[model samples]
Target: MKYVIKTQECGYLFKNGILKKILFAGKYRILSMSGWELKITEMTGKVDTKGLPTELLMEQPDFVSRVVRVQIPDDCIGFHLVNGVYKQVIMEGEALYWNVFEKNEIRLVNVTGTEMTEAQVPAMYRHLIPSRLYKRLSVGEGETGLLYIDGRFEKQLSSGTYFYWIYAHEVSMKLYSLKVQQLEISGQEILTSDKVGVRLNILCSYRITRPLELVQKTDNVANLLYTRIQLLAREYIGGFRLDELLAQKEEIGRFLMKQIQGVQEEYCVEILNTGIKDIILPGEIRDIMNTVLVAEKKAQANVIMRREEVASTRSLLNTAKLMEENKVLYRLKELEYLERICDRVGSISLNGAGSVLEQLAALALPKG
Candidate 1:
């Protein structure tokens, strides 16, 4: 029997149900007892051997096409997972041939190992690997990262890049700052020794002295530290009256620093500074203080004025006593008063015209 072969079709010659040779792009005549299998494939390709069985096609590598061939370069590796299970790992710079005809799959995995272990291979297929195979942890600057595996602390890393593989145990990281940090505890209202309610704003600057103790010993170190600071500030403020606190705020700062010293060791934090940022009195109290300040200033002004007036009066009395003790000085004073009177009168008229000059001189200082 004769079969008509198209130019785009490849013919497989079989005798007694066994493949013998391949036919390409031509008409072919077959014997009546033999059979012919024709398949259409893209000629432009390396002749897609995807539909062909790899076990049988690999035997004739020369005639096979690059349908499912995976090439692993020198810097990479290839993994082949068969039937959803890891079967083989190809090392650097290797080529693997495969086809889709079999019920198997092959994927390429890039890793760094001369040979991969069976235990290290993921049980899943290649497509779902990257998300399940490994994990990454970034320890930023000024932060210390703590690595934990299966909820157990492993090691602490400082400001760097880290990578880990996840197969059986769960992996995670906790970061704590190693730099100086500031916390502002604001809007706290406490009672003073004078039973006056005053609002306080506090600022604290500190750093992590012991990272391991801060992270492992306490679950919420920041909250605990804040609580202690707040309590200490209140206790210290309660010991002083409003007037005393207002007089010397530096004293409150000193007391606050003293109180926070013990908190540093307890929470593993170095208390660099602690101070009261602002002291806000109640409206009524602020008004009362203002009134008191104004009244005290007025009393001081009145005292200064009375002192100046008394000093002036005593000086005048002493000057009068000196003038009475000396007659010539008294006569000089009479002439001084006459000069003052003449300065006020711009034009003075003398009654005695002929004796005006002599009379004026005599009236100015008589017989002195």
Candidate 2:
């Protein structure tokens, strides 16, 4: 039999079901045996050995000169480049490509005890890499991230995406909010100086100023701040009487800011503002206050009624004195009384009287 291999093709010569040699771009006369064969393949791309031993294939210096061999280590990755351009990513394994026509290169990178940097592998090939081979972290806006490798602090990351290979190291992260956040300490019970129990709800706004210092000082910054505020509130409340605490509810908030000045610095936080939301009194105290208010209002009403009566009496006495000083005024008062009496009586018949006007005047006068 006669076999012809093209200039851009390779021929694998097999004799009795075994590969004998690799033929490249040549013409040869092969015997027509039952188990003899010549497999022709294109040399434009990867060379497929089809389970043939690479050592046996490399024995031919002519075959070795025409192709390139890549042995990717188990802990390393290979980036295949053709004609000075990225073509494919080669995982852990062995690969072979023809170098006769175009230039070929396999960039080997060790993925042990190191992160995946953009310089090591270009950003354009991020999607080409396998997802399981690397770890990804996204730090959103108004937040900062702390990166740790093998339980040791490494560095801080701003708001962006980061990639690291999980080869032989453990990767962990901690996020801290930079914006102001509210903390509510609701229904906290305390005793006043007068032994009065009160429940208070407090709110405070804060933000993390130094995330690294906070992490080093305390395991949880929020918890530390909460405890400080709670203790200060209790101490301030315990010093004031019940009446004073109720009168100066806003004073408690101001006291908190002054007392927590040192603590805020230690915790690496900025205290924006603090306030007392609600002050809950006991049922017994509330009832007593309601009763006292009702009694006070009743007393005020009585005093106002007595004042009005005294004013009315004084006005009457002044009018009587004016009438006594002048007979004309006395006559006018009598006529005024008669006019009022006539309005009430529809009809009247006088038998013992000098004239109707004189008799009416006499009747208007007081009997005493």
Cα lDDT computed for each candidate against the true fold? 0.69, 0.85
Question: Best lDDT goes to which candidate?
Answer: 2
Off by over 4 Å in 2: 1-8, 15-29, 34-36, 81-88, 99-105, 287-368
Q: lDDT of candidate 1?
A: 0.69
**C-alpha RMSD of candidate 2:** 7.8
Per-residue lDDT for 262-339 in model 2, tens only? 677878998988888899999999999999999999999999999999999999999999999987898888778768
Stretches of model 1 off by over 4 angstroms after superposition: 1-18, 21-34, 38-47, 61-129, 297-368
Backbone clashes in model 2, listed as residue pairs: none
How accurate locally is residue 21 in candidate 2, as Cα lDDT from 0 to 100? 79
Residue 331 shift from truth in candidate 2, angstroms: 25
User: How displaced is residue 39 in candidate 2, in Å?
Assistant: 1.5
Q: Residue 21, candidate 1: how far off, in angstroms?
A: 4.5
